[model samples]
Target: MTAPEKPRSPLARLFMGADHTLDRLLAYWFATCAFYMASLAVLVAEILAGTTPPQAGLILIGAGMAGVTSFYLLVRFSQRLGLEYWQLALYQAVWAMGCIIAAYAITGPIRGASMSLMLVVMVFCTFALRPRQAVALAATAVVCIGVTMWCMARLDPAQYPPAVELMNFILIALGMTGVTALSGAMNRLRARLKDQKAELQKALERIQTLATIDELTALANRRHAHAVLSAEEERIDGAPGPVCVALLDLDHFKLVNDRYGHACGDAVLRAFADAARPEVRNRDLFARWGGEEFLLMLPDTRLEDAHRVVARMKERVASVEVDGVPPALRITFSAGVVQRKAGEPLSDAITRADQAMYTAKSTGRDRVIAA
Candidate 1:
């Protein structure tokens, strides 16, 4: 019996990697910088109030320096933990927790320091945790804060006069935690939408390329070539400008496949395409017609000029080398070039070009025939 199908890994769901990783790192750095700024403000206030400034200043400075260093480290090393997404998520969570601990040590509730810990809950919800994880983390924050308040009460019972303050603190923490969870859900939704948008754009680009490109020769295929010719024909009529169409047929291509394998014949076609591609203008359209034939639309070119272009293309094709072939192995093409006549259909011009190409083939194997 077949084994049960394995689940798709988390990495499979994450399609955007290169840019997404950098974006996460940048978000971490910005959040870290904001944490440092808030911490700095607290430390400065302590100093101005004549609290022993040196110790607090030293500790705050150390924390800031460590944060800056960790920012660079996270940026560089996060990707090395590939497929270990939990590790990255944990890093973000733990980093935020460290800031909470730092804030509490220096100035607990006296300066509303413990209140800042709410930021940690918010960060967990925003960057690292899913709904369940966020709820668990929020519960953890509440428990920790309760324990601290209980300890503070036990240490100096008179200082903690009323339970009202404790209630307010708990309520504020819950409120912040809820806000963070809600915002995190929204952020996750946005991220998923962005990922979907990127995927759709990639699929559309692939479809566009497939629509225009020839499967065998990798040139523009017949459908695209015909469309381009028709468009150019219209342009010529509207502007009263010259446009040329050239039909190229391989000289004795059947003999090549008969002598060599079909693989070798395909190689010759690809080679011819590669050689011809650079010879045509960037604005010119090139396509593979049916077997052993090609069509080119040269906008703003006269028939004489188009003939010269195809002649050079033939020379390039003849120069290509096929390894493991006989010393006398060579390839050539016959081309029919025609100009768009005034007030005429583009298909007629293409037909005329085909006739001229056949005339060239009948007269000689490798020459251009212009009509």
Candidate 2:
């Protein structure tokens, strides 16, 4: 009996579950909630120590709770409300800016802790917003902080020294703008790389399809057919049933080309493929072996069963008509079918089928010979 598999790591499962955009947004919301809780604890401690005014602490707590509640509602109903990621980012940015302004008013412009938080918000915007939007947000933040500092220094000189206020404003504005510019450049570089990667993937896929598929008949090409035969031969080793390989050649194909030109010959080939494809079973493999020749591999089928399938295909081929050809003109194919013997190589089976096909051609123009 097989042993029971070990469970996946909890951390791995968590990350896998968080792969969606909504899940990541929820994660960010939870992190922000924790940060607010910690900040509230610190504010309460400062109030108890008489370092911060009770009224100021109360205001900060109220604002923090309001931000938390807004984020919670947004997270819970974002999908129902059809809120896009960019819209959510814009709302967060606006809320953050408002919170910073309120904190600056209570804590003093030059030495407010909220000034540092504003820098964090600016950096975050660089990642969430487009380059132009990020730059606009940075500029708006700088102007707002500058205006707030100027007003504070003029209306309350004791609390906000003009020299200190000016220095803080310059430092914070420069920092926010620098980060925004760098992040925008990085985002553009990343987008270019992503497009290049996608184009490279498409190129590789086209190359693979060209290599394996016949351009004219849309069937598996000679190389792909041989690989399939080899794989089937290996797979059926010591198995319960027979594997049949049939080689089919359009009888007197040159007569069509000589009579109607190569263009009509191509049409006949394509029409034969269209007629024959419906006769092939899903489990069987069919491919264009070469010019006017095709190959079929039928797993778990006997030589006689393979003969019947090819006979049906021949009937279908005869009924197929090409443009510019007379109604009296009929198309037919001679096929050779051989069941692979135990431990026999695929090459030997294919050679025997080819010889049988030649025999069928020599004996009668359109017939199936089993070897």
- Per-residue C-alpha lDDT of model 2 across residues 2-61, encoded as one tens digit per residue: 876455567845533323546677777777778668767866776787666789878888
What residue runs in model 1 are displaced by over 4 Å at the alpha carbon? 1-161
TM-score of each: 0.58, 0.75
lDDT of 1: 0.73
Residue-level error in angstroms, candidate 1, position 171: 2.4
Task: Mark the 10 consecutive residues where model 1 has the least summed lDDT.
Answer: 12-21
lDDT (Cα, tens digit) per residue for candidate 1, span 1-371: 98764544566324323344455555656676686677667667766665524576667667666866675565555676452444555555555555554444345335354565566546555655566666666667666666666665666556553484477457757776676668667777978998999999999989998999987789998889878877776677778778788899999889888988799889889888998898988899889988999998888888788888999998888888875456587778999999988877878988999999999999987888888
Residue 209, model 1: lDDT of 89
Name the lDDT value of residue 57 in candidate 1.
62
lDDT of 2 at 183: 76
